[model samples]
Target: METRFLKWAEILDFLILIGSSVTLVAWIFGVPLFYHADGPVLSIFTSISLLVIVSLRLATRHFQLWPFTANLAFLMIVGGGNISSILMLLSAPAVHINPKSTLVMTSISTSIGLIFFSFYEILLYLRRTPNRFWILDDILIHLALVPGGLSLIGHIFQNPNYLSMSIDPRVGISLLEMAFMALLALSTVLSNPNLFLWKFLKSGTANQLIFVGLFVNQYIAPIIYLVLMHDDWKSGDFGPELFIFFGGVIATLGFLLFQAKLEENNSLIRSGIN
Candidate 1:
């Protein structure tokens, strides 16, 4: 029953992305949703990010491609955690979104997907389907990503001030760079999972080189550019800043540790030695 629900959740989450067709269109227009930069540099960088993400999607059928899938999902999940839009639908006045109108539309859809995907991954880990849920690897990922995503769901959806929060462009871009680093670390750690995709990836040296290069270029490089040019190197009280940025890391680690304890107890029961 849990497994079935998880599968449905993944389907529904993907459907949300599909519903946000505008994002895909904007992606094609060389306009990456989160980055609000203009000019040729942004155009080229977003184009490459699109190229890599699309490639990851294409390879999903035959290979696990968790790196790509997870990153894509993360993009959708974090694009815009704006609460004002939902609040507006509930009769509250609409609030401004930092991203442009077109981008905001897509980001809203992505933001909504967090609730479903986070639950799906949790069920996947708990269900422990053969090698599909390796304790060491899956734990690390869920620890880093799941809790962070879910914890912020409330802030994005319920807090009216969330969308209105002021952030230094440089800070936002730097935070994004840190996100890319977490993703890269995830990809490296789970590189050799026991799966069919591993065999395919291991066939030649070219695959590794291409995958790593695209990983950096498609995801990391753009953020580097964004932060470099993004200005406002200022400091302030920054109250909610902790929740906005590093919340995911703290949540991930805490939840995974607790879940690990539960899984250990469940394993003992399954083995019937106790």
Candidate 2:
């Protein structure tokens, strides 16, 4: 199942690459299709970052396409691209580079996510043995997810508050950028099926229970809670703090349920083995 899932993820990554490439081309050619008349437009930097990371990911899929040094070089290239993007955004206004351009400035979340992802990949490449190093990878992945996930939620809820966490007050994430950043993040995580959640999932014990627990906690429950509170959220009656509090509660409960289910499944597996 893990192998099949990874295969599908690769295919999805390819499609994302093609879409991002098209968007980049449109940006270069001044195509209006991807441009919004009065809304956030996808930045050239975001498009380029998407293409680089997605291509790097697909290129290194099996780790057979490149040697260790080559992979490191590519990772450096990825890091450089993001840093250059940050510099460009910061300096664009000062230099008056296409001051009337419709493209939105790249959000800090997008750049930081890519940087953390690069670090995650580098750690994977350099690890001599699994050990607790994978915990570090897990930490990086989650940290990467934090900003990108906030951008996604901000877009989903049409709230500017969630989008302005970038260093530049003017920078905001577009729907396109947020969506692909999310897909790229997920693709990055899926690239290594031997780590973290993937490892537990590949264990093939309590698949249903695990799936249900995560779905409810991560998706169904929070979504429902947010939906119930969205009107108040918009009216200033509800704030992010409350949202975070409830979300933590839900997550804790879900974790307990998931643990219990996993234990039950283990007992069954043990009995069957006997």
Best by TM-score: 2
Instruction: Give the deviation of candidate 2 from the true structure as CA RMSD.
Output: 5.9
Listed per model in order, the count of residue pairs whose N, CA or C atoms clash below 3 Å is 2, 0
* Candidate 2 residue lDDT tens string, 126-173: 873252222556556656655655555555665566655223334556
Q: Look at candidate 1 and tell me the lDDT of residue 82.
A: 28
List pairs with backbone clashes in candidate 2.
none
Candidate 1 lDDT trough over 10 residues, lowest sum: 167-176
Model 1 global lDDT (CA atoms, 0 to 1) = 0.36
- Which tens-of-lDDT digit does each residue in 41-143 have in candidate 1? 1122222332333233334534774564464454443322224333442342234333343332212222232323333333433443233223454444333
* Total clashing pairs in model 1: 2
RMSD of each: 17.5, 5.9
Give per-model TM-scores: 0.31, 0.70
